[model samples]
Target chain A: MIGGRPDMVDDEHRLKMLMVAGLGGDEAAYRAVLGALARHLRGFFRRRLASRPADCEDLVQETLLAVHTRRHTFDRSQPLTPWVFAIARYKLVDWLRRHARQDALHDPVDEWRNDLAVEGGQEADTARHDVSELLGTLPAKQREPIRLVKLEGLSVVEAAERTGLSVSAVKVGIHRGLKKLAAQFRP
Target chain B: MRTDDLVALLARGAGTEPMAVPARVWAMAVAGGAVAAVALMALMLGVQADLAGKVSTLAWWGKAGFTLAVALPALALITRMARPGSHVGRLPVALAAPVAALWLAAAIQLAGAPPGERLALVLGKTWASCPVWVTVLSLPLLIAALAALRALAPTRLALSGAGAGLFAGAVGALVYTLHCPELDPAFVAVWYVLGIAIPTGLGAAVGPWILRW
Candidate 1:
């Protein structure tokens, strides 16, 4: 049922082509595949982690790293979606297991259902807090541009102007900030 | 970090990174493990004095064939499990086939033997030492295969470990055949199978911890 849809088939074909090319050392194709996968993985994690939306991006990054590092395991002849999603599913399960253990330690069994039922506004607030906390971990040079360009939706030029940095510096800040954020979840 | 940034970073290293080919990795593991196991068997137990004579016999071929049949399917199972979401379709059945065939042969052999000799046929001369030897010999292959699995991605950690163990154990038994003189079907059906099972159990038990990414 997964690849039965026409659009799904197109995605499968396109992604498989990109993945194959990527495996053959085509960096652009590799980047394109990862970019497309990021969109899909964001949706996948968001749906699964609805109760803890703050964790979706972390899980997405983790799965993306797993996919990138384990790309060699992918059979060139196979469809790309299942292989990619399988890693996603594994990361989801792994994340859930680790968090479940932590949740068990911090929260009583009686409050578990209530935690799951946290309302939308509260969830958004928590997500925002988590984003700021993540950004807070970066140095000012990286943090300010990431906040402005990524969180606050400023253009790179505007962020550079606001921070008194070159446009390239602002771009580098965002990139390095994002890289650091991804690395935080590595272990 | 934004997913886009992470993707960009990952792509930057793509062409420069050395990709591990699954087939090549596994082949090296199996080949290296087999060689190590054969050398270990030679050093520890020494080849049976009649190995040259035995190779031409049906019983020797049966033992080799049984171990091979099990090992091949187990290798297939582990290969399937190395990748996430890959089905191990019919492989379990294939792995079981040799044991079933051997057991059937053992039953027939027992039926034909005198009741007094039946126990001897089942126990053979080295019943206590056989399984133990097989398990010990499997260590190299188990370590090698698991190391290979570690380099790749295996989502079902325990199952993949068990597959590696099964493959290692069977290969171990195959190598053990170089030294084992007993050719009774029942003895192999029971003790050789036990030898393979030890590693399989060990693999399953340690899989979650060792195979963790």
Candidate 2:
């Protein structure tokens, strides 16, 4: 019943092919799959998180990462969209659970405007500023690597070179920095 | 970081080799846990004395068959849970079949027995220790199975944990059969079920916490 429609079948087939190729170490296919999943997940979360629209992108990113890390769990025989949607749903449930208390506090009008602003270019600047402010709170060792590798879009090796740290250290810094950043979001 | 950048990084990090298949992972977990449980059983309680004599008996086969039946379905369910959006259709029914059959056998056995012997049939010589030992033995398998589930993605955390626990319980009961001498269908239907239930409850209780990714 899932892919009964022609369009749905095509979408499922295409995503499944890309995913299978991605599992076989095809970087382009993997990137393609991730990009495609991101678009779907953004819409998926936006609809569910309408009251907390600002959190939609964060949930999309989280679900995408989860899908990437848990890629091995995908059974090739199964349809890809369901698997992707399941992960998206799990992330949505988790986010909702975590932010349950904040639900009542959010102003619907403000959130609607925020959602529109995020669609516009100006919100990107505010997001970047907010992210930098968060990075500033981390220790220099953790901050520098995340700022370089994540925020600045540098590879681990490049971040290592810039920070004068070993590649492993840079990776560790990013890992720890992300963990700290995530912890800050928790109550 | 932006979502696009995150995807690019993840794509870059995708290893040349895919992870071991789910079947292989589950096999290793079950095998490893079985070995640990067997070892623990041997250390705590030696195998039943009439080993050669019991092999040909109907009770022995019944006990083993029941445990195996439960284990197989539990295994199937747990594997399904490891994947997202996979249907667990008919698995719960499969898992219940053996239990229902055993209960039927137990009922017949109890009915045929004399009034005074009914309680005795249900409560065999080792009734008190059987479930306890079975639960104790399930610990290692539960740990190993949970670890395996953790390595894979399980969207339904509590269900996955319950599946793992059910698998562990069935396997643990299978391992317990090595040392247990009781053979009454009533005893197995009651005590063994209790033993398996303990871990299933434990798994469900802790699932939301431990299975959090």
- Off-target runs (Cα >4 Å) in candidate 1 are A107-187, B16-20
Fnat values, one per model, are 0.48, 0.56
Interface RMSD of each: 7.1, 4.1
Per-residue alpha-carbon lDDT of candidate 1 for residues A17-65, written as tens digits (9 for 90 to 100): 9888887878899999998998898899888877666578677777887
Best by DockQ: 2
Clashing pairs in 2: none
Question: In model 2, which regions exceed 4 Å deviation?
Answer: A101-187, B17-19
lDDT of 2 at A125: 10
DockQ for each of the predicted structures, in order? 0.27, 0.41
Q: When only chain A is evaluated, what TM-score does every model earn?
A: 0.60, 0.62
